[model samples]
Target: MDKLRKALSGRDNSDEQEEERGNIMTQTEDTPLLRVMDNSTLSWNTRVKGFAICFGVGFLFSFLGSVFLFLPNGITIFAVFYTIGNILGLGSTCFLMGPVSQCKRMFATTRIIATIIMFAALAMTLVSAFVLHNKALALIMVVIQFLAMTWYSLSYIPYARDAAKKCFGSCLDL
Candidate 1:
């Protein structure tokens, strides 16, 4: 025990000397915010889960769109459009997370413009089909189009923002 104590005592003195001379970097071993951004950064496992969920959801919707596109009488075209848009939207949301939130205002305009154009085109198609007496088509189109866009935007945006904010920080010490 004496020998062990002596060894530990010697090592501690060397560390203390290094610290005193500023030759060693002192880490904040007790700082709670070392890796956490705003105290809400997710754990590694949570980030992995979020990425997996986004990828899986996007793939599922895109595959569903493909299947719906091949249905008889083109009845499922609306479903196809909706699924396609949402899949793309989800993917884009994941890609452009940095820009979607208020942190990056420059890209917000482009994101908003593209979304409006996409939804407007969808609405126009629905209107044309309804006016031409294609009730089945119009029903499929309008319901899915509106709901898919709304659902994707509502569910994905906040999630992306949170994840991005956690992964990154509003300010960097560097």
Candidate 2:
């Protein structure tokens, strides 16, 4: 019984130690924003949990939005829910990569155009839904949003954009 108890306590201690190791932060250059991000960084487990919850909510919102498309005022409802889901999904990445790093990557030269288009599409989606109330325009903007987001995501993978361009060019030529 005593041996079993020691083993259980040892396991608990190792878990705590592992958590502490994950929580340790390394010093970086002393800039105000970096300092804030460094200070605000969460433990690995907490970060993963936050990311999962946020991403799940984002997916649910998008699914609900799609479901509402057949009802009255469905376009506006769909636009709003879909836009919110995209925002949440984008924001969820910040949990895995610090906000500063995420922003830097977002605005990087290769992806800047895609990022701008994505953001513009998101804004236009809302504007079309609320202000213009044009279902066709809203749908168009949603398509743009999805494409821009895809392009932006592809920018993160090396040569992905080039490969896509080549594939599309060949298809167009054919």
Candidate 3:
């Protein structure tokens, strides 16, 4: 009886230790959604990604726009428009990153939608660059990137606010 009790106690102590270790591990380092999750913000991943995609798109097109048009024209009205659009797109993308880093929830549909937007923007950017062969195509790419940034910001702001009210909508407490 004494020996059996000792073994049981030993096993229980080890189990408790393992649990503590696991908790420590979990507390450190977080995923894109996890930071937001702690704050009850779940839609950050898509938001950040959406913003990032836009920034990338904007930067690339703006570079092209500048190289192909602005330099030659010396910052005309069209150049200013392109610059303004690209700057807005970049700013929106940067803003999305903050919320995304805080997000903790995982929703497949949101991710899918974000992915679709990213891929579509990428394809559009390339298509416009190669096939269209005009200033309009560049303008279109800048506009699309800006739109993506706007959409991401719109989707995230509400999610962060809503998440603050509920943890994972049913899981983990923020």
Candidate 4:
């Protein structure tokens, strides 16, 4: 946790370590860390980037999934969409970590919205699967995806708010 704090602040405790070694600490006001901490707008910019990336991924998933649906071989198309969707969704979350770590409120809000959308999407997919009465492979994939999304949202929501509070005092603050 201390390491995380240091990385997020872009600061090192070398000055303090030097002081303990009977060495005098030099003040470096022109350091990048100083500039970063002094500028509140950078944080806001990061949040904007984060939100855009998340929304873009969701859009891509929907578009690609729709396209795949029109292809031949129902089971194969569903499998492709299921695999790609999960991979892309997880990858996008990894990208969001930078902004999420910096802007807690924005992260929490976006994550919650994403969770809700994921739930709805899964529900709709299940209904479609049942109606289509296609191959068992597609149905099995949907069930797996449903379980994964359900577990992810359930576990994520329970701690997301607390993590946001610990990372930042208020939403949209630098």
Candidate 5:
């Protein structure tokens, strides 16, 4: 049990000097957020689980959208999915707080821009599909969302992988 606790805490007996630096620096290494973002052994597992969760949620939303896409009020279903996804996304942002705080000056504006574009696409989809009830416009919004997602994946994923590499050394698999 003690071994398990120590391993989970991410401490090495050889790193006693780190503890003297300060509580925040010492505690940060063991934080779950940091582990998710940077730990070589654990980050990949956490990322896989997060990907699964996002995929499952997205599948559910897609299924619902397909089921109601033809109905007169079908767009509302997609709107609900958008709302739920947004809420989930907001909750997930908490995981980034530690990393963001630790390296505020390092964050790239491109990442922020890509994220904003993605959110704008979501908003466009919700407004066009649900509020305006314009199927064609909604389709356009979806295309925009796809493009935004591609942009974000290209820009942010590489940045995150690189950051993880820097944090955990080249051995970090991201």
Candidate 6:
């Protein structure tokens, strides 16, 4: 019994040490926001799980939106679902990278314009769907949203935008 108790206590101590090691890996910044974000950071396993779940939900919403595109009065439904899915998909990165880092990367100079356009397109999609109730306009906005999002995503890959531009330019020249 005494041996078992000692082993249990040792296990507890090792767990505590592991936790301390994890905490040490997270660099603390002086800013309050950074500190708060650091404090809220999840374990690696939790972060991975959160990312997977959020991304899966986002993909499901987008697929459902596409399915609704064929039904009557479905443009509005499609727009809403698609917009929400895009938002969720974009937000899922926050789980992998803390919110502060995610926001910083999104607003970084290289991708700022694309990010802004994507956000505007997302907002306009919903506005056209619900407020204007214009199916054609909503569809147009959804296309814009997709293009903007694609451009924004490409910004993450080095020189991808330039390559895309060159490819399009060559195709147009043909």
Q: By the lDDT metric, which is better: model 2 or model 5? A: 2
Candidate 4 lDDT score relative to the true structure: 0.52
Candidate 6 lDDT by residue in tens digits, 19-122 = 67865435454576655465244666687688899999998999999999999889999999999999999988777766766787899999898899899989
Please report the candidate that would top TM-score against the real structure. 6
lDDT per residue for candidate 3 within 1-174, as digits (tens), equals: 545433312325765587577754367787865654332232555555766777777667566656656455433334444555455464553343343332321124554464356446645655655566455765676567556544544454547536643654667643
Candidate 2: segments with Cα more than 4 A from true spot: 1-36
Candidate 5: where is the Cα deviation over 4 Å? 1-20, 23-51, 82-107, 156-174
lDDT of each residue in 55-174, candidate 5, tens digit only: 567666666666676777676676657445543543343333323432331245756775677678788788886678787787777767766665655553547646644767856655
- Residue pair clashes in candidate 1: none
Greater TM-score among 1 and 6 belongs to 6
RMSD of 3: 16.2
Error of 1 at 145 (Å): 9.8
RMSD of 1: 18.0
| Model 1 Cα lDDT, one tens digit per residue, 42-109 | 44345446556766676676566556656664544544455454545445433222112322322355
**CA RMSD (A), model 6:** 10.3
Q: lDDT for model 2, on a 0 to 1 scale?
A: 0.81
lDDT of 1: 0.48
Model 4 per-residue lDDT tens digits across residues 4-69 = 434544336773476466432135545655543342224534744755676577557646765776
**How good is model 4 by TM-score?**
0.39
